[model samples]
Target: MRAARPRRRFLGLTATMVSAALSAILAFTVGTAAPAAAATRTVNDIGPVVSSLELNKGYEISRDCGFTGVPQANVIGVLWLFCDTAVSPTGQRVWGTTAGTAQAFTAPSQSLFGDFTDASGNNVVQFIPNPSGFSCGGTLAAWASGIASIPTSSPNPLLIIPYVVMCLNGTNTRPLALRIVDYDYTTNTFSNDSPVGGTGIFTGNPLADNRILGSPVVYNGSLYFYTGLCTSSAFGDCSAGTAQVAKVTLGSTPFAAYNASNQSGGHRWLDPRNYTFSTLAATSGGFTPITPASFDVHRYPAFSGSPFVAIEQDDIGGNITVFSSSSPTGPFTPRFTAAVPCNSTTGDGGLCRAYIGHPESSTSSKLMLSYFQPSDSHGNGHVRTAWIPWS
Candidate 1:
């Protein structure tokens, strides 16, 4: 049940069609309120109103990272962001730049930051490599981590995004680092904190090397996370070739604190000891996809008239799945499924956060996915969208 533009029509209509497409997702959707009038048009025909919410066109620091959904709409001016390192942090390792100045690029020291506004907005950045030096290829691939957003402080109710780097340079054996960033209103910037938490691998924690892939989701006022084993055998694993889903709620000290740990022993919950992450088996129809070394499971539970969890499965195929969950921690059942048209193979590369949009005054939803073609260098990728009807 999908629609494809005719070759001839697609070529001629590229510009005008894009203009018309804008009508369905432009500045009419804001305040989180549904349209007053009932939708009289079919899902495909009805035009959606894009909310006033605009992505800060801050610089894309990573040659690779981008977020799915609208969790970052409120960020004003230039937004600061970070991600795992796929390549070495040294400047001499860079092959070359596609469009920008090559010398302007430097390796991310402990982490990297960028300034962005709406996609149409101008973004500026300066990369300064770590003095201690780093040890990755000149590629920036997606690594495993557990991402969550929590309130920064009282009175302002600002949000802070936390990332637990359980793997380094997309490899499992690498040690983990706990990174935190506080959003400041006065300066419209983020202040990053380092290595607040350390792993117990040396202390013989079996789960120490297992990589975490999912972001934070709220259920009954508590926070939950999804985790899985690193594809690379270098990391420690309780079980090989299997994934584990778990839940960890914010403790009493829910807000961010200096030198404080994000997880307490009682705060984390496992998947009933019987659940596994690979419910969707690998495709067996003679598809020679590249094998992904690592992946993260980002879930979008249904809301606003939709009832599916959009899981962003990176690596092989760069595909995404929509699952239905009666409870936050499944027994998650699979439902609708879609993938980026390009790079539907399980090769050495990976993709993250395929974006999905639920528009106002509409019965259908839009899914935006991104991927890099194997032939490209630096893993430079592009984004595409698909529309699915509610009826």
Candidate 2:
């Protein structure tokens, strides 16, 4: 049976609405200590609580790379933030305006995952690149070793962000790969470390069409990844196709590291064989429309009430909807939908996409939602961070 959830009438994100939302979440919630009773903050810039934890002032350093969850690299008390850059890797020096510029990528380095200090104390970045015209990507072990080779002596090394690779080269063969890149906090330049973690291709046929939908978001301590599988030569084996979810704990030391060290040995994860997928089932026949990719997953602790366990995703119509569930791979119940609070004075109107959440910026009262607004035709836009009540 599904647990009773407290649903809120989310009109818009503001100081006033946030207050009411928190009340609703806590009212029907029963669990650990409730979030703080009060939540009031000044809504600034293009909108309330602009994105990237208020680091960028509506000016995008790189489009769609604004999700800066909990500061990772620390040098002299400075948190070096990590996010993706179309042609290069980007970093932001927290508490200051000293910015790091992006360089070109050999294969146009694509979506990057969260930042973490690695075991060696070096600030390492993990990214999933959409392979373009490029040579054979290197080995997964080499990639892991290269990033691990960075010479730095920090404290905690947090690597990997539950990102699935997609090389998509029908003919080319590369052992399941994910590129591990290193970002120099002091220099701000992104360098391709060693082995390239390329795409994972299962269907040998070109028309097979295997895909991982939406986006990968970390909830609680596990990574919620959804994938769709379809094959042709096998005929009706998977006719209707099967949707499966892979739940990887964040501490798996990134896919590259796991592929390198435990490809055949160590057992750091609970998944059978270090990799067994669970299928997501539908209990009912007809279901409400759902978001393709859940942009943000609030890292609400298990005890922090029921409503707080939510996945925030955006519809194609540009609406940001909230859903609640007991499990990360879930049968989510739609709580409410709200128009993205995006505002702009330049170009066409403002449209927000990529509703990412920053756990470090969240409190008991609110979840920090980061997104890109007023983007160009190519989906390039400045970053905006907003605080939404999620008690």
Using TM-score as the measure, which candidate wins?
1
TM-score of each: 0.48, 0.46
Q: Residue by residue across 1-391, what tens digits does model 2's lDDT show?
A: 1111111001001000011001000001112211121132332223422223223222233333343322245432222232322211234312101122222111111222223323652333233333233333431111111111121244343322222222223334222322234344544444433233222212121111112222344455544433333222121121222223433333434343223333232112123222322111111121133322333444354235633334333332345555555765455455545556554323422334455544444556555555556453223344455655553
Off by over 4 Å in 1: 1-62, 68-157, 164-175, 178-186, 189-213, 230-241, 251-253, 256-266, 271-315, 318-320, 344-364, 368-391
Report the lDDT of model 2 for residue 56: 25
Model 1, position 129, has a per-residue lDDT of 20
Error of 1 at 128 (Å): 13
Instruction: Determine which window of 10 residues in candidate 1 has minimal summed lDDT.
Output: 8-17
